[model samples]
Target chain A: MAEIAIILLNMASYVLVLVLVALGLVVVFGMMRVINMAHGELFMLGAYTVVWLQAAGAPFWLAVAAAPVVVGAVGLVIEAALIRHIYRRPLDTILATWGLSIALKQAVVLIWGPASHSVAAPMAAAIGVGDVTYPVYRLLLMAVAVAIIAAVFWIFLRTDFGLVARAVIARPDTAAALGIDTRRIYRASFVIGTALAGLAGALVAPLISVDPQMGLGYLIPAFISIMVGGAGPLAGVLVGGGLVGGTNNLATVWLSPVVAQIVVFLLAIVIIRLRPQGLLGGRDGA
Target chain B: MAPRWLAGVVFMALAAFPLLAADYWTGQLTRYLIFGLFAMSLSLVWGRAGILCFGQAMFFGIGGYVMAACTMGLVGGALTSSYLGLAAAVLAAAGFAALLGYFLFLGRGLSGAYLAIVTLAIAYILEQTLKSAYTLGADNGLSGVPPIDLGLFGASVELWQETPRYYLVLAIVAAVYAALDRLLASPFGVVLTAMHGDPRRLAFFGYHVLSLRLIVFVIGAAVAGLAGALFVAVDEFASPTLIGFGLSTEVLIWVALGGKEMLLAAFLGAIAVRLMESTFAELLGDFWILALGLVFMVSVVLLPRGLIATPLGRLTSGRHRDGT
Candidate 1:
């Protein structure tokens, strides 16, 4: 029973990580219909921001705070320069962003040698939950992930910007006729999604190996989650993340991580086969 | 595609290349020719048929493994024939493609981005599986596969020398290219092109869209597998890299930058990238990749017609056909 509780805690934290990483991917790929292949690199850049800032003696919390701003700015530049022009061509977007990812990764390799950097957790206290004593930072990570998801949900549900963004996503022509400036909405959503990815990277920096190639390890899994969860609805993030992440983590505990990954991919394929449009999708984005 | 006369000239140049070039460069060119063949296969599936097969390297790798196994006598004790190996390699990849395509293109049928994502996942799975299969050398890959051995009635000629190997590869690749070019110009190509433009419209005209899609996919896989098989012989080894995300994406870049729509342009794209890589890889190293990335992005955004294709179009303007 204690082992079960401990396993559940570990799975929760892992699911949170998957959700955090996938937030940006879902927003961009799911909502915008833009295949931003460089998203993982953006996440890498986010982790690097904290790494560099902490290296400069900034507090870990401050570094985390700066991640969104810095990453958002970078995302802005990417949009203005590359993503803005090719919104209609899905295949081109993939190639262009793949190129962007390659460039971004190489830029990091040039800036920092391709070595993994470790960040110390901001807190080390242990809190007892049921029979398991979990690390406080991990518990805090879960809380923070939930808060971010809630904030995103609230934004999409309640805000004027979210309402307009949905309008643009659903019917850009009608939104433009209503003077909605769909272009600006696109730019904003792209930046938000990218910033979210960066924040997720910063959050995971202390737990995972922070390297130029760190984003790649998460890239496919994030993609899997987005695919399994469905990309049309925002809530798909939770559903897909829970399924992919929970299964992976649970299987990791029982089997090997590699096998767990394969299992998740197989699951994703089966699910996709069953529902080509995704579990929660509408209007045939799939 | 290259104009007939221009293609003749290019073939003449290729045939004459080994005389002026070093043996080392000849061997390198052989590999590039195989890559060029691989790029053309992608052009047919992606450019002509509008299928973005992201995990193309999976078929390529499958071919390499089968070829290596057959040629090395790993599969059967007495079946070390290169001819049999190549045939088996092509069949294996095509068979895999048929099975995968039946699921992916049939029923609810994934298209565009969804298809790309699914293919990418499957490729990742195949690569991971290869890495974990300890019997297949567990990521280090199978090595020491012999070169192509040509058997006649009384004697056999081993492609031990660079010149012979290069010529053999050139002949096979040239044959495949010509066949594929003809195919694109046929009524079959017209239907595939129509389907790419609007599958719904084509379906209304009595075309079996699913079968066409599967057939083209299988053809592409067969070509890629042939390239992979030939690669094992030329490289003298088969590794996990051939069947994974890296090569898959690399090939995508080649086809896209070359112009996914043009067969000859795509072929040249792979060769040009290889040439530049060999040159700049030594001087600038990683920065070269950065520059390549920037160029690819700019080309994709601004020159959607393609970077290499844009210029090549001008070169073969009057000579080119709609089939090309």
Candidate 2:
């Protein structure tokens, strides 16, 4: 019974990580209709920012806080320089972002060298729960992920900026005609997505080995989750993350991690085959 | 579209290349010729059929594995013939593509980025699977695959020298290019163009869009498989990286930079970019990636027609329509 509880906890934490990794992609791809292939690289940049800041004698908390800001600023520049030009062309956006992803990855390698780095977990204590003890940091990460998701939902559903952003997403031409400054909305939404990805990366940096290629490991799963979830905002990501992450975790118990990944990927392919709009997506899922 | 005489001229130049270059350069050009064949396969599906396959190396890798298995007598003793190996490689790749295409294009169909992403995922999965499959040599890959042995009813000849191997690969590439050119100029090709221009309209006209897509996908896979088979013979080895994401994207960069709309341009693109890499990689170190990225971005954004294709298209009276 205790083993079951521990497994469930582990699964929940894994699911939360998956959700966090995919959150920014959901916005950029789902909301903006822009396939940001460099989304993973953005996450990497954020983690690197935290590492660099903490390495420079800054407090760990301060480094974590500054990660999103640094990544967001970088995203803003990318949006202005490259993404803006290819917004109308989805295929071109994929290619362009792919190029950006490669450049960013190589740039990271150039700056930091090829060696992997590890960050100390800020809260390095475990709490007893019945027969099993769990890391406090893992639980804290779960809470942070939940909070971030809620914040995003509230912003998109309740805030004025969210409203305008959705308006632009739904009908860019009409929104532009209505004097909504659609371009600014695009820029802001892109930045928000980038910042969220950065935050997720910062939060999880201590959990995994940090390196230039770390982002790529997360990229495939995040893409699968978002794709399975459909391109919708909150509901899509939630359902997609739950299904993919849940299945992946459960499968890990029965199968090897590699086999589990293959199963999850095959499952995703099956889902997309059956429901082209995704599980929770409407007609405009594309 | 590129003037029929140009093909002959290029083939003649390639045929005479060994006479001008040393043995080392000849061997290097053999590998480039194989890559050029791979690029042509991509151009067929991406350029002519309007399906931008992001994971083309998957087919190429599949072909290489099949060829390696057959020639090394890993599959069965009867399949050890190089001729049989090449045939099986093409068949295996096309079969895989056909199966994948059935799932992908049978329903509402995955198009554009969705299709690209799914293909990329599949390629990644295959690469990972191969990496762990110890029977297939895992990360070390399969080595010592014998060179091409043409034995027709007991008369056999092995292409062991660089010049012979280079000429053999060149002839194969030229044949594939010619066949593709003929196919692209046919009535079937006209329908393919129409399908790309507007699939829904073509479907409304009673064309089986899914079947057409599958056919083209299989053909492209077959060609890619042939390239992979030839490549194994040239390199005498096959690794998981041959079928992975990095090589897949590298091919994409080559094709895009050369010009996807024209087979010749894309083929040249692979050769040219590879030549440049050989020259610049030593000088620039890791910065070559940055340069590649910048070139990719610039080509996609500013010159969608590609560096060679854009100028060449204008010169050739713009016969081929621009495609992404």
Q: What is the TM-score of each candidate against the true structure?
A: 0.97, 0.97
Candidate 2 lDDT by residue in tens digits, A36-155: 889898999988988999889988879989999999999999999999998888788888899999999999999998888898899889999678888999899899889988998899
User: Where is model 1 chain A poorest over a 10-residue stretch in terms of lDDT?
Assistant: A276-285
RMSD of each: 1.9, 1.6
- The residue pairs in collision within model 2 are none
In the order shown, the candidates' DockQ scores are 0.86, 0.75
Question: What lDDT is obtained when candidate 1 is compared to the true structure?
Answer: 0.89
Cα deviation at A185, candidate 1, in Å, is: 0.8
Off by over 4 Å in 2: B318-324
lDDT of 1 by residue, B1-324 (tens): 567777677778989999999999999999999999899888989999999999999999999999999999988888888899999999999999999999999975988888888898898899999999987887899999999999855368789799999999999988988898899889998999999999999999999999999999999999999999999999999989999999999999999888888887898889889989998999998889999999999888888767788877777785553422
Residues A23-128 of candidate 1 have per-residue lDDT tens digits of: 8888888657899889999999999999999999999999999998999999999999988888887778988999999999999999988988999999988888
> Which run of 10 residues does model 1 chain B get worst, by summed lDDT?
B315-324
Candidate 1 TM-score, true structure as reference = 0.97
Work out candidate 1's RMSD over C-alphas: 1.9
Give candidate 2's error at residue B188 in angstroms: 1.2
